[model samples]
Target chain A: MTVKFNNRDPVYVQVIQHFKEQIAKGYFEPGQEIPSRRELANQLKINPNTAQRAYKEMGEQGLIFTEGNMPSCITKDEAVLKSVREELIIEAVDLFLGSIKSIDVPLSEVLEIVKKKHDAESGEAEGSK
Target chain B: MIEVKNVEKKYGKKRVLKGLSFTAEKGEITCLIGINGVGKTTIMKAIMALTPINSGEILIDGEKIRKESFEKITFIPDTITMLPQMKICEAFAFMADFYKNWDSKRADELLQFFKLDSTERIANLSKGNMAKVNMILGLALNVDYLLMDEPFSGIDIFSREQIAEVFTSHLIEDRGVIITTHEISDIEHLIDRAVLIDNGEVLKEFSVEEVREKEGKSVVDVMREVYRG
Candidate 1:
């Protein structure tokens, strides 16, 4: 999976957001083993301390957990998984609404455009499959 | 910790460092940033004691710099330090001979990581490959503090990316690093603190995260404010 990070925010926060997005998209399934902190740091080209901080924050958020010395895994709790998914959806909708509000277009027109875009994307996905 | 207190240096009649002072704490990457000819390298040279200071003092871990301290700190100059005629393996042997802390296994690992063949002559390698060799030489030594002077200078984008990747890996995790670079974008996210230098003086020094949190400014933004203003 490819994760593109914005330079404006703290890197660990962006790393957590990337993992959240992956989890919400079902790319990282529940109870799947995630990369170790060092591995993640090496892959992302961030400081190892930043990777450790990201993992710690993710653990605190109940998004991932570690057992003994084993590597961390995605949360297996259905409630946590559902909340993570819903939170991402809400965040996307809020961002979309905020951006659209700055323009002159009405909400209904923006919704229509989004519907067309979504349908076209899903159609392309089905064709590829 | 490496601390420089009111350090001053001069060449002939021209002063290079004018009462410059800063601290690089243990387990942190502190970047020394400024435009070219702003004495960024001068400060690094003074810290390494490669160049004599006119006044003031530099301390590594609360002790004055001495021959023994040289073993504790490794300085990687921007240009290649090894003889141009030496092959990569010969350079490695040179380092192994001089430094008691040199780890040949680590050197071999870094050589493989940088995709450098030990048989290649240093003079024949590309600019990027030469820089990689320079980095590997400095990193193979087990030292508490690593001072890199413009490690990113005059390198290609791909080489810079490879060197930047080293910051994240276990290769540099425990040491206190003080790196001087005019190009901050290459290491914007990796640095813990930035010491902004202008005219041989530290204009400002602050933790990067604190600046991001309090002022919503990246190191580049802060540089613009300090330099442009």
Candidate 2:
């Protein structure tokens, strides 16, 4: 798929975040073979060293693993998969709350609006199906 | 590593580079960024020994630049260095005859990658195509370092896109690349380090990732602080 990176954060960090997002969305199934470091660098137009760093960091975080000379693959650990899902949800909620905290709207109104929007999106997904 | 230590240069009575020093490491892309008339091109020329520096030293892998060093580093100037009358194929032949490191297979691959025709005359090619040919000639060489002077400058958007695509390809990997450009956005994500220059002096040298992590700033943001402030 498509990953759009912002200019603010370090690219390697963003790359890790992109993989996490993909995994959380069930796009990258557990044990799926990911692109090699060179392939990742070419696809993202980043330096190979940066891609290597991203993969290294991902490995450290248990988001991916490598065996011998084989290419890196998504983590098959259920604990890591659960944590990744929780991490993304927490990040999304933190962002949502941080943004709404500065506004004049009440929490109840914001929750109602979010609920309506969520239902609308769910309805659209079902309609498409 | 390509190191320029305390480089000083002058044009007639005017001093251009005043104690300029920077190191571009192997396996990384170091960008030399500054406004016009700030000696960006002069630094590239000095590195190539095209214009002799008034003082200081430039070392390639810890030795002074010499004829042998020429085989290890390739410099692609902004303008056409080849004879304007020569076609793309003839230019390739000329390079092959001169440089022992020239790789005909790599040149052929780059020619196809840039979608350049070998029979097309250099003089008749558009500015973008000329830039591509210039890049192809340099990249076809098996060199440890590549110095590019304004590869993205004065080119069409489509040509710039094509050139940007080449940066990600395997063609230029694992080489120390020193690129001087005012248009930083074209290769912003691709560069590993940024050396900001102002009035012949290096204002700052920082890794792009360091700036992004510690200061939450891009190279352009850093440039604004150094140049505008």
Candidate 3:
């Protein structure tokens, strides 16, 4: 629930991004209840209007839903959830590729290093578990 | 809405407010930002009718501020105004007697929220506790608009953060808040709009989110461009 927000980006946009990341990471399950805009504002130490705006945007994007008097909940649609995960993966890979492109390394060599790093990190995670 | 239109103020030969204008809507926090002596406190005082303005008009909702406006608005000065010998509960009794809008229940709630001991004397309070007590005096009222002067200034970072938390909590409700501060880094995210002042005039008045959305800039970035450009 804690987010160290950057000052430059619109706070509502950052909030939406945070929600998307949580959904993609499986931390927010499908159809899970979400905090009310006011509660979110208090918890995040952000303006209530910004939190409201973020919720409105999320509703429009089908990332969350509200029904008569009930608290808003994460979208239960599988396609939307799948797309959110794909979107985050693509974004992270694009950023990584952009950084690697500046170094002019061959794709084959870069993929080999990526595979090795990924395996080592996953192995550590497994050992910890 | 609290409308301050083309307001001007003077002190002896010096002009403090030069046709400053801004509107603070209910349910939003409008910040008056400037360094020391740029007339931020002067504007708050003018709105409260604590001082005379040379020209222009100040309005609450639509009508001009009057004796009854005190019921609709409250001002929290930077310092605690209670007697040093008074206990925290005694100060609450004083406020309850003086202001019809004072809510003793909410005052008690704020005392618990701040973790302030009701039996503690004002003279024994640390600077941080005094600031919190000052805030409670203003906030424990059934008023629509709240004006605060330098609530975070000259306090510890932890105290500053605690005060900042008040802005986001239900304690504020939908009250129109006009807060003056020379320092904004701590509560920048909590305000709806910022009115940047320099030399008694508004340099820029903008919605904080709109600036970030449209110009890709933070409040500090705009301040740098306006103040140093």
Model 1: residues with Cα > 4 Å off, grouped in runs: none
For candidate 3, what is the interface RMSD?
A: 0.8
Q: TM-score for each prediction?
A: 0.95, 0.97, 0.97
TM-scores for chain B, in order? Answer: 0.98, 0.98, 0.98
Off by over 4 Å in 3: none
Number of clashing pairs per prediction, in order: 0, 0, 0
* Tens digit of per-residue lDDT, candidate 3, span B125-145: 999999999999999999999
Best by DockQ: 3
Q: Candidates' interface RMSDs, in order? A: 1.2, 1.1, 0.8
Q: Which ten residues in a row have the lowest lDDT in candidate 2 chain A?
A: A1-10
Report RMSD for candidate 2.
Answer: 1.2
lDDT, candidate 1, B1-229, per-residue tens: 9999999998899888999999999888999999899898888888888899999999999998899987899999999989999999999999989999999999999999998899999999999999999999999999999999998999899999999989988889989999999899999989999999999999999988678767777888889999998
When 1 and 3 are scored with lDDT, the better candidate is 3
lDDT of 2 by residue, A1-129 (tens): 446777779999999999999999999999999998889988887778889899999999999999999989999999999999999999999998898888879988998999999999999999999
